[model samples]
Target: MQRQFFRYNAKSFPKCYRELATSSSIFLIFTAAIAGCTNSSLATKQQPATTQLFSPQTHLASQPPRCQTAQLSVSKVSTNAGAGNVAVIYAFTNKGSSPCNLYGYPGFALLDSKDRPLKGVKVIRSQGTYFSKQQSPRQVTLAPNGQASFEIAYNQVRDVGQSCPTSEKIQITPPNAYHHFTLPEQINPCTGQVRVTSVQPGIIQ
Candidate 1:
C-alpha cells in the first residue's frame, strides 16, 4: 500500500510543474509586448517640429523703386482762327536727363484776370484733324532734351472776352488707367496757352 501511494504523488507532481511553466511563459510574453508599445508611444511624442523666419535684408531687396517726373518748359505759342473761332498753338520741350513717355489726353483751363478757372476750353489734335473732349497727345517718346507741340481751340472767340488774357493754365496728367514709369509736370498760366518747353530732369511727368 505504501509503494502505490508514493507512485501516485510522483505522477501528479510532474503535471503541476508543466502547468506552472506554461503560465510563466504567457506572463513573460504579455509583459514584453506592453513594454514595446510604451517605447513606440514615447518616441512619437518626442519628435521635433519645424518653423520659418524672415530678415530685413531679404525684404528690401524684393521691392522696386517708384516712378519720378522730369522737368518741363514752355517754348513757343502761336494763334489762328476758324471760320468763327480762335485757336492757340503751344510748343513744349523736355529738357530732362531721361526719356519721358506721354500718356492720356491733354487739356487746359483758362483763367480770368482774377485767376478764376474757366471751363469749355477745347483741345484740338492738328495731326488727327479732329476735335474731342481733350486730345491725349500721342504717347510721345521724348528723348532727353526733346520737344513736342499741341494746339487748343476756342469754338467762339467771344467765349473769351477781348480783354481776357491770351494765356491759359495747363496741367499735363498721366494716364490714370495705366501705371506710369514717369509722371507729368504742371504748367503755369501763360499767354494764350500754357507752354512747357523746358523742364528739370526727374520731375514727375
Candidate 2:
C-alpha cells in the first residue's frame, strides 16, 4: 500500500512540475559552477606577478647611458697661490655632438714627475677650505664644444712640512666616469688635505 501510494503521488504530479524541478536543480548546479570559476579567475589576478632581480652593474647597464670618457677632453686652465694654499683649475670640454651631463665631484689623483701614481694621498671632495670656500655640487650640462671647470686646492710645502709630496702630473676622471686624463703641471700637495670641487659650468676665473 505505501508503494502504491508513492506511485500514485508521482503519477498525479504534473509533467511540467516534474520538469521544472529538474531544471531548477540543473540551474543551481550551473550557477554554482559559474561562481566557482569566477572566484578562481579573481584569485589568479590577485596573485603577485613574478619579479626580476638585477645586480648593481646590471642595473646601471640598464639605465640610460651617461657621457663616456672618449667623448670628453680635459685640460688645465690656471694655477694660483695665496696664503698657504695653491688653487689649480682644470677644464672639461665635451667633444661629442650631443649634450651630456656632469655631476658630483671628479675623481683625481696626483702623479709624480715620473708620471707614476702618487702614494699616501688621495683626492677628497671638500666643502671649501682655507684656500677656497665650500662649493656645492650641481649638475652641469655640456653641449657640443661646451666646457666645465673644477678646482683643486692643497697646502704649500712650507705650510705642510719640508717633506711635502710633489706631483708634476694630475690625473682627472669625470664624475661617475672611469677613464681619466692627465695634466702635466707642477703641483705640491700639502699634508693638511686635498680639496676637490664639483664641476662648474664656464671657465674658472
Candidate 3:
C-alpha cells in the first residue's frame, strides 16, 4: 500500500499573501522610476560650460581712454652732449581738461627740411643713456596742463666727410596714438641711429 500527498492550488493561497506580492511589485516599479529621474538630473548637471566670444569693444569700454595725440604737446626742455653723443629731453604736456597716461615709447623719424624722411635713420627704444638715468616703461599719468618727458640720444661723430647726416625736423608718433606730429629740431647723427627712452615723470637732467 502507497501513501499520497496534497495537490497545489492558487485559489487556496492566503488573501494577505496575494496582496503582499502585488504591493512588492508596485514598490519595485516606483523605485526604478525614482532612479531614472535621479540619473537624468545628474546628467544635466554634468553638461559643458558656456562659451563666450572675444569682444574688443567690450574690453576697451572698461578701460580709461588713451591719451590722444591732439591732447599732447611736446617741447624740448633741455639738451646736453658728451663723447660725441647728444641727448635731448622733451616734455609732453596734456592740453586736455581730462587726465591721461602715456605708455611705452614714441615712434620717431628724422626728417629733412623738405619734409621727407631721412635715409638709413633708425630709432631704437631704450631705457637710459650715459647722460640720462635708466627708466622702465610704465604708465605716465598726466593731469590737465601736467607734463611728462622722454629722452633721445644720438651720435654726432664724423661719418662721410665732416659729419654724418643732419635733420632740422622730426616726425613723432606718441605711444598708442595713431596720428603723428612734426617738430623742428637740429640733429646730427653719424651712425644713423637714435635711442629714445620711455615717457617718464619729468625732464631728464
Candidate 4:
C-alpha cells in the first residue's frame, strides 16, 4: 500500500512543478556566477589605483622641478680671511621666473686665467662648524630672485715643494645640476683640495 501511494503522488504531480525545481537550481548557479564576475571586475579596476598610490613616480611628480644652470647666477659676496686660510661664500641667485629646488653638494672645477678646465685638483667636501650642522643634504627651494650659498675654504700657504696652483675662475654646478656657471675670482688650493660645504638655504657662516 505504501509503494502504491508513492507512485500515485509522483504520477499526479504537474510537469510545470518539476520544471520549476530544475530551473530554481539553475537560477542559483547563474546568480553565483554573476556575483563572482562582479567581484573580479572590481578587483581589476582597483589594482592600478593601488599601485599608483605607493609608486615612487607619484612622489617625484609632486616635487618642485630641479634647478638648471641657465636659471641661476653665481657671484662672490665676501670672504673671511684667517691665518693662512680663507672661507668664501659663493651666492647663487635664481634668476628664472619659476621656483626650483637645490640639494647636496655643488660641483667645483678649477679654471685658469683663460677660463680653461684644470684637472687633477680635488674639491673636498667638508662638514665643519662654519656652516649649518645638518648631517644630510637639505633641499633648498628658491623663488624667483631668491639666493642660496655654499662655502669653499682652503689654505693659502702650502708646504715647500708641494704644488698648490692658483685658480683664476671657478666653474660651479649647483646640486644635482648638469649646467654650470663661472665665478671670476682667484682661489688657491694649497693641498690640492678645496673644502666645500653643501648648498645651504641662505648665506651661512
Top TM-score hit: 3
Tens digit per residue, CA lDDT, model 4, 11-128: 4778998788789999999999999999999988885533435679878877879889889998887788767777888888999999999998999888998888766568888765
Model 2 ranges off by over 4 Å: 1-3, 6-65, 157-161
Query: How would you encode candidate 2's per-residue C-alpha lDDT over 1-205 as one tens digit per residue?
Result: 3554434465578999989988999999999999999999999889787888866997665444466789999988888887777888888899998888888888988888787978767678885655556678877888889999888888775643367777788788999999988878666675746788888888766
lDDT for 109 (candidate 3):
87
Q: Candidate 4: which stretches are off by over 4 Å?
A: 1-61, 129-135, 160-163
Candidate with best lDDT: 3
Query: What lDDT, from 0 to 1, does candidate 1 have?
Result: 0.45
Q: Cα deviation of 179 in candidate 1 (Å)?
A: 18
Error of 3 at 33 (Å): 13
**Which residue pairs show backbone clashes in model 4?**
none
TM agreement with the true structure for every prediction: 0.39, 0.66, 0.71, 0.67
Candidate ranking under lDDT, highest first, comes to 3, 4, 2, 1
lDDT, candidate 4, residue 109?
Answer: 83
lDDT of 1 by residue, 44-116 (tens): 8887877776679788664432212335555335555556544454544656776655543443444534454
Question: Candidate 2: TM-score?
Answer: 0.66
**At residue 185, what lDDT does model 3 achieve?**
85
Q: RMSD of model 3, in Å?
A: 6.8
User: After best superposition, candidate 4 residue 182: deviation in angstroms?
Assistant: 1.6
